[model samples]
Target: MKMTDDNKEIIFNNITKWLRDSNFVMSEEKITVVTSEFYAKAYLQSDHEYILEIMSATGIETRFALRIRLPVSEQQLENYENLEPKEKLIFDDKMNAVIFPQRQSINIKEKSAFLEKTISIDPKSIDAKQEVMQNISNLLGSAKKLEISFDELLSN
Candidate 1:
Protein backbone atom coordinates (compact mmCIF):
# COMPACT_ATOMS: atom_id res chain seq x y z
CA MET A 1 0.00 0.00 0.00
CA LYS A 2 2.66 2.46 0.99
CA MET A 3 5.30 3.05 -1.69
CA THR A 4 8.07 1.89 0.57
CA ASP A 5 11.17 0.08 -0.60
CA ASP A 6 10.21 -3.12 1.19
CA ASN A 7 6.76 -3.19 -0.44
CA LYS A 8 8.27 -2.51 -3.85
CA GLU A 9 10.80 -5.26 -3.40
CA ILE A 10 8.13 -7.74 -2.39
CA ILE A 11 5.98 -6.91 -5.42
CA PHE A 12 8.96 -7.10 -7.74
CA ASN A 13 9.98 -10.49 -6.40
CA ASN A 14 6.47 -11.84 -6.74
CA ILE A 15 6.19 -10.57 -10.31
CA THR A 16 9.56 -12.03 -11.24
CA LYS A 17 8.53 -15.40 -9.86
CA TRP A 18 5.22 -15.30 -11.66
CA LEU A 19 6.97 -14.48 -14.91
CA ARG A 20 9.40 -17.35 -14.48
CA ASP A 21 6.56 -19.77 -13.68
CA SER A 22 4.86 -18.65 -16.88
CA ASN A 23 7.95 -19.72 -18.88
CA PHE A 24 9.39 -16.27 -19.41
CA VAL A 25 13.16 -16.38 -19.59
CA MET A 26 14.90 -13.73 -17.54
CA SER A 27 18.27 -13.23 -15.95
CA GLU A 28 18.44 -12.11 -12.36
CA GLU A 29 21.37 -9.89 -13.22
CA LYS A 30 19.19 -7.98 -15.64
CA ILE A 31 16.73 -6.83 -13.03
CA THR A 32 17.14 -3.23 -11.87
CA VAL A 33 15.56 -1.43 -8.96
CA VAL A 34 15.73 2.30 -8.53
CA THR A 35 14.15 4.40 -5.85
CA SER A 36 10.68 4.43 -7.38
CA GLU A 37 10.69 1.81 -10.13
CA PHE A 38 11.64 -1.73 -11.00
CA TYR A 39 12.74 -2.83 -14.46
CA ALA A 40 13.22 -6.23 -15.99
CA LYS A 41 13.58 -7.91 -19.33
CA ALA A 42 11.57 -10.99 -20.20
CA TYR A 43 11.67 -13.22 -23.22
CA LEU A 44 8.64 -15.27 -24.16
CA GLN A 45 10.57 -16.86 -27.01
CA SER A 46 13.86 -16.35 -28.75
CA ASP A 47 12.43 -13.57 -30.85
CA HIS A 48 9.61 -12.34 -28.70
CA GLU A 49 10.97 -10.16 -25.91
CA TYR A 50 9.41 -7.54 -23.71
CA ILE A 51 10.60 -4.86 -21.33
CA LEU A 52 8.69 -4.77 -18.07
CA GLU A 53 8.72 -1.67 -15.91
CA ILE A 54 6.81 -1.32 -12.70
CA MET A 55 6.28 1.99 -10.97
CA SER A 56 4.52 3.26 -7.89
CA ALA A 57 4.09 6.70 -6.37
CA THR A 58 2.18 8.32 -3.57
CA GLY A 59 -0.50 10.32 -5.38
CA ILE A 60 -1.31 8.07 -8.36
CA GLU A 61 -4.74 6.51 -8.28
CA THR A 62 -3.36 3.18 -9.37
CA ARG A 63 -1.00 2.05 -6.64
CA PHE A 64 1.10 -0.13 -8.85
CA ALA A 65 1.49 0.09 -12.63
CA LEU A 66 3.17 -2.37 -14.94
CA ARG A 67 4.18 -1.28 -18.40
CA ILE A 68 5.12 -3.78 -21.08
CA ARG A 69 6.82 -2.77 -24.29
CA LEU A 70 7.24 -5.08 -27.28
CA PRO A 71 9.41 -3.98 -30.13
CA VAL A 72 8.19 -4.18 -33.73
CA SER A 73 9.86 -3.61 -37.06
CA GLU A 74 9.56 -0.80 -39.55
CA GLN A 75 7.76 -3.13 -41.91
CA GLN A 76 5.21 -3.92 -39.25
CA LEU A 77 4.67 -0.23 -38.67
CA GLU A 78 4.17 0.37 -42.38
CA ASN A 79 1.73 -2.49 -42.63
CA TYR A 80 -0.20 -1.28 -39.63
CA GLU A 81 -0.45 2.22 -41.05
CA ASN A 82 -1.70 0.90 -44.38
CA LEU A 83 -4.54 -1.05 -42.89
CA GLU A 84 -8.03 0.15 -43.77
CA PRO A 85 -9.85 2.20 -41.16
CA LYS A 86 -12.21 -0.63 -40.32
CA GLU A 87 -9.37 -3.11 -40.14
CA LYS A 88 -7.44 -0.81 -37.84
CA LEU A 89 -10.50 -0.48 -35.69
CA ILE A 90 -10.75 -4.25 -35.49
CA PHE A 91 -7.15 -4.49 -34.45
CA ASP A 92 -7.66 -1.82 -31.83
CA ASP A 93 -10.65 -3.72 -30.49
CA LYS A 94 -8.50 -6.79 -29.97
CA MET A 95 -5.24 -5.33 -28.67
CA ASN A 96 -4.67 -3.09 -25.69
CA ALA A 97 -1.45 -1.59 -26.99
CA VAL A 98 -0.33 1.87 -27.97
CA ILE A 99 1.85 2.01 -31.06
CA PHE A 100 4.91 4.21 -30.62
CA PRO A 101 6.99 5.40 -33.54
CA GLN A 102 10.60 6.37 -33.07
CA ARG A 103 12.41 8.43 -35.65
CA GLN A 104 15.57 10.43 -35.97
CA SER A 105 15.32 14.06 -36.92
CA ILE A 106 17.95 13.73 -39.64
CA ASN A 107 16.88 10.39 -41.13
CA ILE A 108 13.14 10.64 -40.46
CA LYS A 109 12.92 6.89 -40.75
CA GLU A 110 10.54 4.76 -38.71
CA LYS A 111 13.31 2.39 -37.68
CA SER A 112 12.19 1.62 -34.15
CA ALA A 113 8.49 1.12 -33.50
CA PHE A 114 6.98 -0.60 -30.51
CA LEU A 115 3.72 -1.62 -28.87
CA GLU A 116 3.22 -0.57 -25.27
CA LYS A 117 0.55 -1.75 -22.89
CA THR A 118 0.06 -0.76 -19.28
CA ILE A 119 -1.62 -2.84 -16.61
CA SER A 120 -2.64 -1.54 -13.22
CA ILE A 121 -2.40 -4.04 -10.40
CA ASP A 122 -3.96 -3.78 -7.02
CA PRO A 123 -1.25 -5.28 -4.85
CA LYS A 124 -3.91 -6.49 -2.42
CA SER A 125 -5.81 -8.48 -5.03
CA ILE A 126 -5.78 -12.26 -4.53
CA ASP A 127 -5.88 -12.82 -8.32
CA ALA A 128 -3.21 -10.31 -9.32
CA LYS A 129 -0.96 -12.93 -10.82
CA GLN A 130 -3.79 -14.46 -12.80
CA GLU A 131 -4.84 -11.08 -14.08
CA VAL A 132 -1.31 -10.22 -15.17
CA MET A 133 -0.86 -13.55 -16.94
CA GLN A 134 -4.19 -13.25 -18.72
CA ASN A 135 -3.26 -9.77 -19.90
CA ILE A 136 0.06 -11.09 -21.22
CA SER A 137 -1.64 -13.97 -23.07
CA ASN A 138 -4.09 -11.59 -24.68
CA LEU A 139 -1.28 -9.27 -25.70
CA LEU A 140 0.70 -12.09 -27.30
CA GLY A 141 -2.37 -13.37 -29.16
CA SER A 142 -3.03 -9.89 -30.49
CA ALA A 143 0.57 -9.62 -31.61
CA LYS A 144 0.22 -12.85 -33.55
CA LYS A 145 -2.98 -11.55 -35.12
CA LEU A 146 -1.13 -8.41 -36.10
CA GLU A 147 1.52 -10.43 -37.85
CA ILE A 148 -1.14 -12.38 -39.72
CA SER A 149 -2.82 -9.18 -40.74
CA PHE A 150 0.46 -7.86 -42.08
CA ASP A 151 1.00 -11.01 -44.10
CA GLU A 152 -2.51 -10.81 -45.48
CA LEU A 153 -2.00 -7.20 -46.46
CA LEU A 154 1.27 -8.02 -48.15
CA SER A 155 -0.36 -10.79 -50.12
CA ASN A 156 -3.08 -8.48 -51.33
Candidate 2:
Protein backbone atom coordinates (compact mmCIF):
# COMPACT_ATOMS: atom_id res chain seq x y z
CA MET A 1 0.00 0.00 0.00
CA LYS A 2 2.90 2.26 0.68
CA MET A 3 4.48 3.35 -2.59
CA THR A 4 8.03 4.49 -2.26
CA ASP A 5 9.58 7.00 -4.60
CA ASP A 6 11.21 4.20 -6.53
CA ASN A 7 7.94 2.30 -6.78
CA LYS A 8 6.12 5.41 -7.86
CA GLU A 9 8.73 5.94 -10.54
CA ILE A 10 8.26 2.41 -11.77
CA ILE A 11 4.52 2.81 -12.01
CA PHE A 12 5.03 6.14 -13.66
CA ASN A 13 7.30 4.62 -16.25
CA ASN A 14 4.80 1.85 -16.91
CA ILE A 15 1.97 4.34 -17.19
CA THR A 16 3.99 6.53 -19.49
CA LYS A 17 4.91 3.61 -21.70
CA TRP A 18 1.33 2.42 -21.89
CA LEU A 19 0.19 5.89 -22.86
CA ARG A 20 2.80 6.15 -25.61
CA ASP A 21 1.97 2.65 -26.81
CA SER A 22 -1.60 3.82 -27.12
CA ASN A 23 -0.34 6.56 -29.46
CA PHE A 24 -0.31 9.38 -26.94
CA VAL A 25 2.78 11.55 -26.97
CA MET A 26 4.11 12.93 -23.72
CA SER A 27 5.41 16.34 -22.77
CA GLU A 28 8.21 17.04 -20.30
CA GLU A 29 6.07 18.92 -17.81
CA LYS A 30 2.93 18.54 -15.70
CA ILE A 31 2.86 14.75 -15.97
CA THR A 32 1.30 13.12 -12.89
CA VAL A 33 -0.15 9.84 -11.66
CA VAL A 34 -2.67 9.94 -8.88
CA THR A 35 -5.90 8.33 -7.71
CA SER A 36 -9.02 9.96 -9.07
CA GLU A 37 -12.36 10.41 -7.33
CA PHE A 38 -15.29 8.29 -8.36
CA TYR A 39 -17.48 10.40 -10.63
CA ALA A 40 -19.54 7.42 -11.79
CA LYS A 41 -22.86 8.85 -10.64
CA ALA A 42 -21.87 12.18 -12.08
CA TYR A 43 -22.48 10.54 -15.46
CA LEU A 44 -25.04 7.92 -14.52
CA GLN A 45 -28.74 8.11 -13.80
CA SER A 46 -29.87 6.97 -10.36
CA ASP A 47 -31.95 4.32 -12.10
CA HIS A 48 -29.25 3.09 -14.42
CA GLU A 49 -28.27 -0.49 -13.75
CA TYR A 50 -24.57 -1.26 -13.66
CA ILE A 51 -22.27 -3.71 -11.93
CA LEU A 52 -20.59 -0.62 -10.42
CA GLU A 53 -23.54 -0.31 -8.04
CA ILE A 54 -23.50 -4.02 -7.34
CA MET A 55 -19.84 -4.61 -6.59
CA SER A 56 -18.16 -1.63 -4.98
CA ALA A 57 -18.78 -0.20 -1.57
CA THR A 58 -18.29 3.17 -3.18
CA GLY A 59 -20.54 3.99 -6.11
CA ILE A 60 -18.64 7.17 -6.70
CA GLU A 61 -17.05 7.19 -10.16
CA THR A 62 -13.26 6.93 -10.10
CA ARG A 63 -13.36 6.93 -13.87
CA PHE A 64 -10.63 8.55 -16.00
CA ALA A 65 -11.22 11.42 -18.41
CA LEU A 66 -8.41 12.20 -20.82
CA ARG A 67 -8.30 15.62 -22.43
CA ILE A 68 -7.32 15.47 -26.07
CA ARG A 69 -7.34 18.15 -28.74
CA LEU A 70 -7.63 15.48 -31.40
CA PRO A 71 -10.80 14.77 -33.33
CA VAL A 72 -12.05 11.39 -32.18
CA SER A 73 -14.40 9.15 -34.12
CA GLU A 74 -17.67 7.77 -32.80
CA GLN A 75 -15.90 4.42 -33.08
CA GLN A 76 -12.97 5.60 -30.96
CA LEU A 77 -15.39 6.87 -28.36
CA GLU A 78 -17.14 3.51 -28.50
CA ASN A 79 -13.92 1.73 -27.63
CA TYR A 80 -13.81 3.46 -24.25
CA GLU A 81 -17.49 2.74 -23.77
CA ASN A 82 -16.97 -0.97 -24.29
CA LEU A 83 -14.62 -0.80 -21.34
CA GLU A 84 -15.89 -2.05 -18.00
CA PRO A 85 -18.93 -0.14 -16.80
CA LYS A 86 -16.84 1.16 -13.93
CA GLU A 87 -14.23 2.41 -16.37
CA LYS A 88 -15.68 5.61 -17.75
CA LEU A 89 -13.81 8.28 -19.69
CA ILE A 90 -14.60 11.56 -21.40
CA PHE A 91 -12.12 12.60 -24.03
CA ASP A 92 -11.83 16.23 -25.00
CA ASP A 93 -10.89 17.38 -28.48
CA LYS A 94 -8.70 20.04 -26.91
CA MET A 95 -6.39 17.70 -25.00
CA ASN A 96 -4.31 14.64 -25.87
CA ALA A 97 -3.36 11.77 -23.54
CA VAL A 98 -3.25 7.99 -23.45
CA ILE A 99 -3.86 7.67 -19.72
CA PHE A 100 -3.58 9.31 -16.27
CA PRO A 101 -5.26 8.13 -13.08
CA GLN A 102 -7.28 11.33 -12.55
CA ARG A 103 -8.02 14.73 -13.99
CA GLN A 104 -5.74 17.73 -13.63
CA SER A 105 -6.44 21.40 -14.24
CA ILE A 106 -4.93 24.83 -14.26
CA ASN A 107 -6.38 28.24 -13.49
CA ILE A 108 -6.62 30.36 -16.60
CA LYS A 109 -8.40 33.70 -17.05
CA GLU A 110 -9.95 33.17 -13.62
CA LYS A 111 -11.47 29.93 -14.89
CA SER A 112 -10.19 26.40 -14.31
CA ALA A 113 -8.87 24.89 -17.50
CA PHE A 114 -7.39 21.50 -18.25
CA LEU A 115 -3.62 21.86 -18.15
CA GLU A 116 -2.36 21.59 -21.69
CA LYS A 117 0.59 19.53 -20.50
CA THR A 118 -1.30 16.86 -18.65
CA ILE A 119 -2.34 13.29 -19.54
CA SER A 120 -5.01 11.30 -17.71
CA ILE A 121 -5.06 7.53 -17.52
CA ASP A 122 -7.68 5.17 -18.98
CA PRO A 123 -10.05 3.02 -16.96
CA LYS A 124 -8.48 -0.21 -18.16
CA SER A 125 -5.69 0.53 -15.70
CA ILE A 126 -8.12 -0.49 -13.01
CA ASP A 127 -7.47 -4.03 -14.08
CA ALA A 128 -3.90 -3.41 -13.04
CA LYS A 129 -4.74 -1.40 -9.93
CA GLN A 130 -7.33 -3.82 -8.56
CA GLU A 131 -8.34 -6.92 -10.47
CA VAL A 132 -11.17 -7.64 -8.09
CA MET A 133 -12.57 -4.21 -8.78
CA GLN A 134 -12.25 -4.81 -12.51
CA ASN A 135 -13.82 -8.26 -12.22
CA ILE A 136 -16.83 -6.95 -10.29
CA SER A 137 -17.60 -4.55 -13.09
CA ASN A 138 -18.18 -5.75 -16.62
CA LEU A 139 -15.25 -4.80 -18.90
CA LEU A 140 -15.82 -6.96 -21.97
CA GLY A 141 -19.24 -5.53 -22.78
CA SER A 142 -20.85 -4.10 -25.86
CA ALA A 143 -20.99 -0.46 -26.89
CA LYS A 144 -23.49 -0.91 -29.71
CA LYS A 145 -26.24 1.65 -29.35
CA LEU A 146 -24.62 2.98 -26.23
CA GLU A 147 -27.06 4.52 -23.83
CA ILE A 148 -25.85 7.68 -22.18
CA SER A 149 -27.70 9.93 -19.76
CA PHE A 150 -27.50 13.45 -21.12
CA ASP A 151 -27.99 14.96 -17.70
CA GLU A 152 -25.33 12.75 -16.16
CA LEU A 153 -23.04 13.29 -19.09
CA LEU A 154 -23.28 17.07 -19.00
CA SER A 155 -23.17 17.38 -15.23
CA ASN A 156 -19.47 16.50 -15.48
Candidate 3:
Protein backbone atom coordinates (compact mmCIF):
# COMPACT_ATOMS: atom_id res chain seq x y z
CA MET A 1 0.00 0.00 0.00
CA LYS A 2 1.20 3.49 -0.83
CA MET A 3 2.09 5.58 2.20
CA THR A 4 -0.16 8.57 1.83
CA ASP A 5 -0.39 11.28 4.48
CA ASP A 6 -3.33 9.48 6.04
CA ASN A 7 -1.38 6.26 6.17
CA LYS A 8 1.60 8.00 7.70
CA GLU A 9 -0.55 9.61 10.35
CA ILE A 10 -2.08 6.27 11.22
CA ILE A 11 1.34 4.72 11.61
CA PHE A 12 2.69 7.56 13.72
CA ASN A 13 -0.34 7.49 15.96
CA ASN A 14 -0.07 3.78 16.44
CA ILE A 15 3.59 4.04 17.39
CA THR A 16 3.09 6.89 19.84
CA LYS A 17 0.20 5.10 21.44
CA TRP A 18 2.17 1.93 21.76
CA LEU A 19 5.11 3.69 23.34
CA ARG A 20 2.92 5.45 25.86
CA ASP A 21 0.84 2.42 26.77
CA SER A 22 3.86 0.16 27.02
CA ASN A 23 5.35 2.35 29.77
CA PHE A 24 8.39 3.34 27.77
CA VAL A 25 8.55 6.76 29.43
CA MET A 26 9.49 8.62 26.30
CA SER A 27 11.04 12.06 26.49
CA GLU A 28 8.55 14.36 24.84
CA GLU A 29 11.26 16.94 24.28
CA LYS A 30 13.45 14.44 22.45
CA ILE A 31 10.86 13.25 19.98
CA THR A 32 11.41 14.20 16.36
CA VAL A 33 9.43 13.79 13.17
CA VAL A 34 10.57 13.99 9.59
CA THR A 35 8.60 13.71 6.38
CA SER A 36 9.46 13.67 2.74
CA GLU A 37 7.88 12.67 -0.51
CA PHE A 38 9.02 9.09 0.00
CA TYR A 39 9.00 8.43 3.73
CA ALA A 40 7.91 9.52 7.20
CA LYS A 41 10.01 8.93 10.32
CA ALA A 42 9.82 9.40 14.06
CA TYR A 43 12.77 9.23 16.45
CA LEU A 44 11.91 8.77 20.09
CA GLN A 45 14.07 8.35 23.16
CA SER A 46 13.09 6.90 26.50
CA ASP A 47 14.43 7.68 29.97
CA HIS A 48 15.74 4.15 30.16
CA GLU A 49 17.98 4.81 27.13
CA TYR A 50 16.00 2.97 24.50
CA ILE A 51 15.86 4.80 21.21
CA LEU A 52 12.95 3.84 19.02
CA GLU A 53 13.02 4.90 15.41
CA ILE A 54 10.03 4.27 13.19
CA MET A 55 10.08 4.76 9.45
CA SER A 56 7.28 4.32 6.95
CA ALA A 57 8.41 3.92 3.42
CA THR A 58 6.25 5.34 0.65
CA GLY A 59 8.38 4.72 -2.36
CA ILE A 60 9.20 1.41 -4.02
CA GLU A 61 9.96 -0.36 -0.74
CA THR A 62 6.52 0.33 0.74
CA ARG A 63 7.22 -0.99 4.23
CA PHE A 64 7.61 -0.01 7.87
CA ALA A 65 10.49 -0.58 10.27
CA LEU A 66 11.22 -0.28 14.00
CA ARG A 67 14.83 0.01 15.04
CA ILE A 68 17.15 0.45 18.05
CA ARG A 69 20.87 0.98 18.33
CA LEU A 70 23.20 -1.00 20.60
CA PRO A 71 26.84 -0.57 21.38
CA VAL A 72 29.56 -3.12 20.62
CA SER A 73 33.24 -3.22 21.34
CA GLU A 74 35.96 -3.81 18.75
CA GLN A 75 36.92 -7.11 20.34
CA GLN A 76 33.30 -8.24 20.48
CA LEU A 77 32.89 -7.53 16.79
CA GLU A 78 35.91 -9.65 15.96
CA ASN A 79 34.58 -12.49 18.09
CA TYR A 80 31.18 -12.31 16.42
CA GLU A 81 32.76 -12.46 12.99
CA ASN A 82 34.67 -15.61 13.93
CA LEU A 83 31.62 -17.53 15.11
CA GLU A 84 30.46 -20.54 13.13
CA PRO A 85 26.96 -20.95 11.74
CA LYS A 86 26.30 -23.60 14.39
CA GLU A 87 26.47 -20.82 16.93
CA LYS A 88 23.45 -19.20 15.27
CA LEU A 89 25.35 -16.18 13.98
CA ILE A 90 25.44 -16.25 10.23
CA PHE A 91 26.76 -13.75 7.74
CA ASP A 92 24.38 -11.98 5.44
CA ASP A 93 25.05 -11.11 1.83
CA LYS A 94 26.80 -8.00 3.03
CA MET A 95 28.74 -10.10 5.58
CA ASN A 96 27.42 -8.22 8.63
CA ALA A 97 26.29 -10.56 11.37
CA VAL A 98 24.65 -10.59 14.79
CA ILE A 99 23.50 -13.08 17.37
CA PHE A 100 19.80 -12.91 17.95
CA PRO A 101 16.32 -14.32 18.40
CA GLN A 102 16.63 -14.24 14.60
CA ARG A 103 13.55 -12.19 13.68
CA GLN A 104 15.40 -8.89 13.20
CA SER A 105 18.26 -7.79 10.95
CA ILE A 106 21.43 -6.21 12.31
CA ASN A 107 23.54 -3.62 10.56
CA ILE A 108 26.90 -3.63 12.34
CA LYS A 109 29.16 -0.60 12.25
CA GLU A 110 32.39 0.42 13.93
CA LYS A 111 31.16 0.99 17.49
CA SER A 112 27.43 0.53 17.39
CA ALA A 113 24.82 -1.26 15.33
CA PHE A 114 21.15 -1.00 14.57
CA LEU A 115 18.89 -3.92 15.24
CA GLU A 116 15.78 -3.48 13.13
CA LYS A 117 12.69 -5.39 12.19
CA THR A 118 10.72 -4.44 9.08
CA ILE A 119 7.18 -5.42 8.30
CA SER A 120 4.48 -4.58 5.83
CA ILE A 121 2.02 -2.11 7.30
CA ASP A 122 -1.58 -2.07 6.20
CA PRO A 123 -3.21 0.69 8.18
CA LYS A 124 -6.65 -0.61 7.34
CA SER A 125 -5.95 -4.20 8.26
CA ILE A 126 -7.43 -5.78 11.38
CA ASP A 127 -4.05 -7.07 12.55
CA ALA A 128 -2.00 -3.94 12.11
CA LYS A 129 -1.87 -2.99 15.78
CA GLN A 130 -0.98 -6.47 16.97
CA GLU A 131 1.73 -6.82 14.33
CA VAL A 132 3.36 -3.54 15.21
CA MET A 133 3.30 -4.26 18.93
CA GLN A 134 4.75 -7.70 18.46
CA ASN A 135 7.53 -6.43 16.25
CA ILE A 136 8.49 -3.79 18.79
CA SER A 137 8.63 -6.35 21.55
CA ASN A 138 10.72 -8.67 19.43
CA LEU A 139 13.21 -5.96 18.58
CA LEU A 140 13.75 -5.14 22.23
CA GLY A 141 14.12 -8.77 23.20
CA SER A 142 16.63 -9.41 20.45
CA ALA A 143 18.70 -6.45 21.52
CA LYS A 144 18.90 -7.64 25.10
CA LYS A 145 19.89 -11.12 24.05
CA LEU A 146 22.56 -9.78 21.72
CA GLU A 147 23.99 -7.63 24.49
CA ILE A 148 24.32 -10.63 26.78
CA SER A 149 25.98 -12.61 24.04
CA PHE A 150 28.46 -9.83 23.38
CA ASP A 151 29.36 -9.63 27.05
CA GLU A 152 29.91 -13.37 27.25
CA LEU A 153 32.02 -13.33 24.12
CA LEU A 154 34.12 -10.56 25.54
CA SER A 155 34.73 -12.51 28.73
CA ASN A 156 35.86 -15.62 26.89
Candidate 4:
Protein backbone atom coordinates (compact mmCIF):
# COMPACT_ATOMS: atom_id res chain seq x y z
CA MET A 1 0.00 0.00 0.00
CA LYS A 2 1.21 3.51 -0.85
CA MET A 3 0.88 6.50 1.42
CA THR A 4 -0.20 9.92 0.24
CA ASP A 5 2.26 12.81 -0.02
CA ASP A 6 0.91 14.56 3.04
CA ASN A 7 1.08 11.36 5.06
CA LYS A 8 4.65 10.75 3.89
CA GLU A 9 5.73 14.15 5.04
CA ILE A 10 4.10 13.59 8.39
CA ILE A 11 5.76 10.20 8.86
CA PHE A 12 9.20 11.50 7.93
CA ASN A 13 8.87 14.28 10.45
CA ASN A 14 7.72 11.88 13.13
CA ILE A 15 10.58 9.45 12.43
CA THR A 16 13.17 12.18 12.79
CA LYS A 17 11.66 13.14 16.12
CA TRP A 18 11.68 9.54 17.34
CA LEU A 19 15.29 9.02 16.22
CA ARG A 20 16.35 12.00 18.25
CA ASP A 21 14.61 10.70 21.36
CA SER A 22 15.87 7.11 21.02
CA ASN A 23 18.38 5.68 23.44
CA PHE A 24 20.77 4.67 20.67
CA VAL A 25 22.89 7.53 19.42
CA MET A 26 22.61 8.52 15.77
CA SER A 27 26.07 8.64 14.22
CA GLU A 28 27.40 10.21 11.03
CA GLU A 29 26.28 7.04 9.25
CA LYS A 30 22.74 7.52 10.51
CA ILE A 31 21.52 10.03 7.95
CA THR A 32 21.78 8.80 4.37
CA VAL A 33 19.96 10.19 1.33
CA VAL A 34 20.26 8.00 -1.74
CA THR A 35 18.82 8.35 -5.23
CA SER A 36 15.46 6.98 -4.19
CA GLU A 37 15.57 6.66 -0.41
CA PHE A 38 17.17 7.49 2.92
CA TYR A 39 18.67 5.41 5.74
CA ALA A 40 19.36 5.94 9.44
CA LYS A 41 22.08 4.30 11.49
CA ALA A 42 22.07 4.07 15.30
CA TYR A 43 25.13 2.87 17.14
CA LEU A 44 25.16 1.31 20.60
CA GLN A 45 27.78 2.78 22.88
CA SER A 46 29.35 -0.26 24.49
CA ASP A 47 32.65 -2.09 24.52
CA HIS A 48 31.26 -4.22 21.73
CA GLU A 49 28.95 -1.86 19.92
CA TYR A 50 26.50 -2.62 17.14
CA ILE A 51 25.24 -0.76 14.10
CA LEU A 52 21.53 -0.53 13.41
CA GLU A 53 20.62 0.18 9.80
CA ILE A 54 17.19 1.63 9.08
CA MET A 55 16.33 1.64 5.39
CA SER A 56 13.50 3.52 3.74
CA ALA A 57 13.24 1.58 0.51
CA THR A 58 12.40 3.37 -2.73
CA GLY A 59 8.62 3.43 -3.02
CA ILE A 60 8.20 0.91 -0.29
CA GLU A 61 8.60 0.85 3.51
CA THR A 62 11.35 1.38 6.05
CA ARG A 63 13.11 -1.68 7.50
CA PHE A 64 15.80 -2.22 10.09
CA ALA A 65 18.90 -4.45 10.23
CA LEU A 66 21.42 -4.88 13.05
CA ARG A 67 25.10 -5.74 12.73
CA ILE A 68 27.82 -6.25 15.29
CA ARG A 69 31.57 -6.40 14.93
CA LEU A 70 33.14 -9.74 14.02
CA PRO A 71 34.83 -12.15 16.40
CA VAL A 72 32.48 -11.46 19.30
CA SER A 73 34.29 -11.72 22.63
CA GLU A 74 33.37 -14.05 25.48
CA GLN A 75 32.12 -11.16 27.63
CA GLN A 76 29.93 -9.93 24.81
CA LEU A 77 28.50 -13.41 24.37
CA GLU A 78 27.69 -13.55 28.06
CA ASN A 79 26.07 -10.13 27.94
CA TYR A 80 23.86 -11.33 25.10
CA GLU A 81 22.63 -14.21 27.21
CA ASN A 82 21.63 -11.77 29.92
CA LEU A 83 19.23 -9.87 27.67
CA GLU A 84 15.57 -10.36 28.56
CA PRO A 85 13.40 -12.76 26.59
CA LYS A 86 11.14 -9.85 25.64
CA GLU A 87 14.09 -8.55 23.66
CA LYS A 88 13.79 -11.67 21.47
CA LEU A 89 17.33 -12.73 20.90
CA ILE A 90 18.08 -14.55 17.66
CA PHE A 91 21.22 -16.56 18.12
CA ASP A 92 22.67 -19.76 16.76
CA ASP A 93 24.70 -22.22 18.85
CA LYS A 94 27.57 -19.76 18.45
CA MET A 95 25.81 -16.95 20.39
CA ASN A 96 25.49 -14.55 17.47
CA ALA A 97 22.18 -12.71 17.59
CA VAL A 98 20.21 -10.53 15.23
CA ILE A 99 16.65 -9.23 14.96
CA PHE A 100 14.32 -10.48 12.24
CA PRO A 101 11.48 -8.63 10.58
CA GLN A 102 8.36 -8.49 12.72
CA ARG A 103 6.27 -9.78 9.81
CA GLN A 104 8.45 -12.82 9.22
CA SER A 105 7.72 -16.13 10.95
CA ILE A 106 10.19 -18.97 11.28
CA ASN A 107 10.42 -22.16 13.31
CA ILE A 108 13.38 -22.39 15.64
CA LYS A 109 12.96 -25.91 16.87
CA GLU A 110 12.33 -29.10 14.88
CA LYS A 111 9.74 -31.82 15.58
CA SER A 112 7.93 -29.66 18.10
CA ALA A 113 4.15 -29.32 18.51
CA PHE A 114 4.55 -25.59 18.06
CA LEU A 115 6.19 -26.21 14.72
CA GLU A 116 2.90 -25.63 12.96
CA LYS A 117 2.10 -22.61 15.09
CA THR A 118 3.20 -19.37 13.47
CA ILE A 119 5.37 -16.91 15.36
CA SER A 120 4.18 -13.38 14.87
CA ILE A 121 5.21 -9.90 15.92
CA ASP A 122 3.26 -6.95 17.24
CA PRO A 123 1.47 -4.94 14.57
CA LYS A 124 2.65 -1.68 16.11
CA SER A 125 6.33 -2.55 15.54
CA ILE A 126 5.77 -3.35 11.87
CA ASP A 127 3.63 -0.26 11.40
CA ALA A 128 6.33 2.02 12.78
CA LYS A 129 8.90 0.94 10.20
CA GLN A 130 6.35 0.56 7.43
CA GLU A 131 5.31 4.17 7.96
CA VAL A 132 8.86 5.32 7.30
CA MET A 133 9.10 3.47 4.02
CA GLN A 134 5.63 4.54 2.91
CA ASN A 135 6.76 8.13 3.31
CA ILE A 136 9.60 7.59 0.84
CA SER A 137 7.22 5.79 -1.49
CA ASN A 138 4.78 8.65 -1.35
CA LEU A 139 7.53 11.11 -2.24
CA LEU A 140 8.20 9.15 -5.43
CA GLY A 141 4.59 8.22 -6.07
CA SER A 142 4.11 10.43 -9.14
CA ALA A 143 7.29 9.19 -10.76
CA LYS A 144 6.29 5.59 -10.21
CA LYS A 145 3.06 5.97 -12.17
CA LEU A 146 3.22 4.68 -15.76
CA GLU A 147 3.30 7.40 -18.43
CA ILE A 148 0.90 7.44 -21.41
CA SER A 149 3.94 7.62 -23.68
CA PHE A 150 4.93 4.09 -22.62
CA ASP A 151 1.57 2.69 -23.77
CA GLU A 152 1.80 4.45 -27.11
CA LEU A 153 5.31 3.09 -27.67
CA LEU A 154 4.09 -0.42 -26.88
CA SER A 155 1.35 -0.18 -29.55
CA ASN A 156 3.95 0.74 -32.17
Among the numbered candidates, top lDDT falls to 3
Clashing pairs in 1: none
Q: Model 2 — TM-score against the truth?
A: 0.28
What's the lDDT for residue 27 in model 1?
Answer: 50
Task: Tell me the tens digit of each residue's lDDT in model 2 across 1-156.
Answer: 333333433444554445345433344323233431221111122312321111111112322322212222444445544545554434321212321222333222221122212222234455553432222122211111122321233333
Worst 10 residues of 2 by lDDT: 136-145
Which wins on lDDT, candidate 3 or candidate 4?
3
List lDDT for all candidates, in order. 0.55, 0.29, 0.62, 0.35
Of 1 and 3, the candidate ranking higher by lDDT: 3
Choose 1 or 2, whichever is better by lDDT: 1
RMSD of each: 6.9, 16.0, 5.1, 19.9
TM-scores of all candidate predictions against the true structure: 0.61, 0.28, 0.69, 0.36
Clashes of each: 0, 16, 0, 3
Decreasing TM-score order of the candidates: 3, 1, 4, 2
Encode model 4's per-residue lDDT on 1-156: one tens digit a residue: 444434434454456556556444666443333433545555434421334344444553333322222233344434444546654333221112111222222222322101011111122465775554343233222112211222222343
Runs of candidate 1 with Cα error greater than 4 angstroms are 27-34, 45-73, 79-109
Per-residue lDDT of 13-51 in model 3, one digit per residue for the tens?
Answer: 666677677666544422234443222233334435456
lDDT value, candidate 3, whole model: 0.62
Superior candidate under TM-score, 1 versus 4? 1
lDDT of 2 at 151: 26
How far out, in Å, is residue 50 in model 1?
6.9
Highest TM-score, which number?
A: 3
